[model samples]
Target: MPRITVAEQAGVGLDGAPRPSEDVVLVRPDAVIVLDGATSLRPELPSGGWYAHRLAGQLAEELAAHPDAALPDLLAGAIGTLAAAAGLTPGHSPSSTVALLRWTADRVDALVLGDSPVVAFGPDGPRVLADDRLAAVPRRGGGYRDRLRSGTGYGAGHLRALRAGGAAMDRLRNREGGFWIAEADPRAGHRARTARWPRSAVREVLMTTDGVSCAVDDYGIFPDWPAVLRHSVDKGLLSVLEMVRAAERTDPHGIRWPRPKPHDDQALVHVDFTEIPK
Candidate 1:
């Protein structure tokens, strides 16, 4: 069997509230899953974190029951189950990003939706598999933090602006020239990027939510994906989280990165396959 380890932490919100992390990590004998819940703009419905937690639980159950189901089919089933339970309406519900890796005796498979990432370390080195179409959307100037500090401080106006922005972005999802995400729509799952590798060729794998990966993606804390993996293997994933927090602390005003929130929910799972018999 392969050896697997995981690390995660919830971050403080803009109001300094210690909310539950919106990320989920699940390690099964045959698969590893990581999910990142998107923050909700509307306060009426259950939070994105709540939706993500529920969805993750459902996915785990489904995957365990039918381990051989195709990845897209499993995701579709999970989305269908959750949409009914949460009374979610198409294009109007809280959603999450999905990153999954599954292995069999002969091969390994990976799928990524939204911005979450999966890194495969093989004989060729490290290959980062990420879906970054979300980053292509046209965003307004000034980060969410900047708007919060503007005058209202996350007041009704701020929320309205957020809702408007989200609505505008929704029109572009899962379409040509637009990005795809795992929402109430099962079709999004088909849009996810999937790849397979010979089991013997893969040495190890790493899966992470955008929060943890932002260190390399946004902060430039590490030189590359291999460095990030080496640091995680040596010092644990929390070390990377601390590095991100420290860097954000130095630029709380968004002068450096210009992000929405100071800190985000972080989660990571590392799978070591060396012990598995070749």
Candidate 2:
């Protein structure tokens, strides 16, 4: 059996608030898991981390027990578990983006629920696996949520906004939009992004929340991913925390940007998939 190497990090953004946890994993044969929680300013919804922890723990178990289950089925099961564990009425409860990558000798299977992204790079180039509505929003000025809130609620108007959101997402993020996981709402619909990996010449794999993905614009598709992954491996979760701290140093609401988006929490998990045994 080939061994697997994994790393994760969480940090406060330039705004000085805690970022949400956004990475989750269920590595089979060699299990590795990362879960990220979304941070919210609303005092009424304080359990983003709690929700992520519970969902990741339970989902990891379910995936471990039945590694062969369908991706959608697995997600449905996880969602049910989350709703029950958090006592969330489908109407209430903080929702999160979920991404899982499980691989075997010949295939790599991935699943994504929200805007959090999953990206893969290899000898060929970069390819995106799972993308969500949030991917479309302009990340430069906190347009991701700003655009979401500007739309009509969850009906047809909301779906239109989401579609419009993607069109608005500029692929200028350095390496282009390789796959990355992002935060999302459950009511957002079934348009999940998924893929099976090709082992030949594959070099790297990354699963990150919007915080890191948003920064990808700074690096492009492959960006400084290898360094970022290595940093996470060396510094552990705190490495990501530091990145969030760096983003926080900018002050989202500072005079630098005139009007600024509310500071949001962030988490990122970077892995050298090639480093994981095939």
Tell me the whole-model lDDT of each prediction, alpha carbons only.
0.81, 0.52
How would you encode candidate 2's per-residue C-alpha lDDT over 1-278 as one tens digit per residue? Answer: 33344444544432434554434444555333445554433347645676676777777777877788866566667666656665665424555567776665666667776556666667766667655445454355433345434432234443344334433432321123422222222322234566777656455667766556655543232255555555556676456555654654564433332212233345554546555454
Best by lDDT: 1
Kindly give the stretch of ten consecutive residues in candidate 1 with the minimal lDDT sum: 149-158
TM-score for each model: 0.90, 0.63
After superposition, the stretches of candidate 1 with alpha carbons farther than 4 Å from their true spots are 140-161, 276-278
Off by over 4 Å in 2: 1-7, 13-33, 135-190, 218-248, 251-266, 276-278
Q: What is the lDDT of residue 111 in candidate 2?
A: 71
How many steric overlaps does candidate 2 have?
40
